[model samples]
Target: MEWMSWTVPTAAFFIVIGLILLGMTTWELRSPSVLRKGLLPIATTRGDRLFIGLLGSAYLHLLVIGATDWSIWVASALSLVWLLAVMRWG
Candidate 1:
């Protein structure tokens, strides 16, 4: 139908996000200690910060991007919750 224009731009936007995530992942791997601190400065170290950031970022992107598609949004939200639970329990 007339989905070409919308699809192209949406795909491009998602691709850019993917690239940014890739860069962040690479940086995180190289310097995980930098991410240990929680955003609010809890007693966390660089590793914890990185872990939380990764989970939070995924949570945010999934919530916003998948808003129109509730199923995906829920999946993303659950993942975030799961990550937080794991961190707290372990």
Candidate 2:
């Protein structure tokens, strides 16, 4: 990680993402998700929703970083909320 020049925030981001993927995989093995309709027009499985949420979060972070001077943690929190919302009721 040091050789990669990984900063704390960058490391933390990847760690959290890795943990989320692990947890989701475990949960899926225990109780597989069925495709279902949510707020998103198309029916989606858990993996689909997860992908969408993460992709959207990336975009959200980029938008905030590019358009504003607020702390990156702000984007992190907002992305977390967005991910949870999509997972729960997308």
Candidate 3:
């Protein structure tokens, strides 16, 4: 445990991921998902859209960091917006 070197952001990130997974599980149990087409141009289930959104957000952050001098907060905001859009209408 001492060797793990867990920082606040790292711990928070993992905690958020865990919470998202738990929430998705609960939502699934409450109401089953069906595949449907959206702005993504392909049918996808809720889980699929979630995966895509997360992946895309990662890339968006990386792209912003690597390609510009803007603050990470901007990238984070953009990623959050993208994630919400995908989850809502992807």
Q: Give the top-scoring candidate (TM-score).
A: 3
lDDT for every model? 0.60, 0.91, 0.95
Model 2: per-residue Cα lDDT over 10-30, one tens digit each: 898899899999999999999
All candidates in order of lDDT, best leading:
3, 2, 1
Give a tens-digit lDDT track for model 1, residues 28-64.
Answer: 6987633232335466654464466566767766766
What global local distance difference test value does model 3 have? 0.95
- Name the regions of candidate 2 deviating beyond 4 angstroms: 1-3
Tell me the spans in candidate 1 whose CA falls farther than 4 Å from its real position: 1-6, 35-90
Q: Alpha carbon lDDT of residue 20, candidate 3?
A: 97
TM-scores for candidates 1 onward, in order: 0.34, 0.89, 0.94
- Model 3 poorest ten-residue lDDT run: 1-10
Q: Model 1, clash count?
A: 10
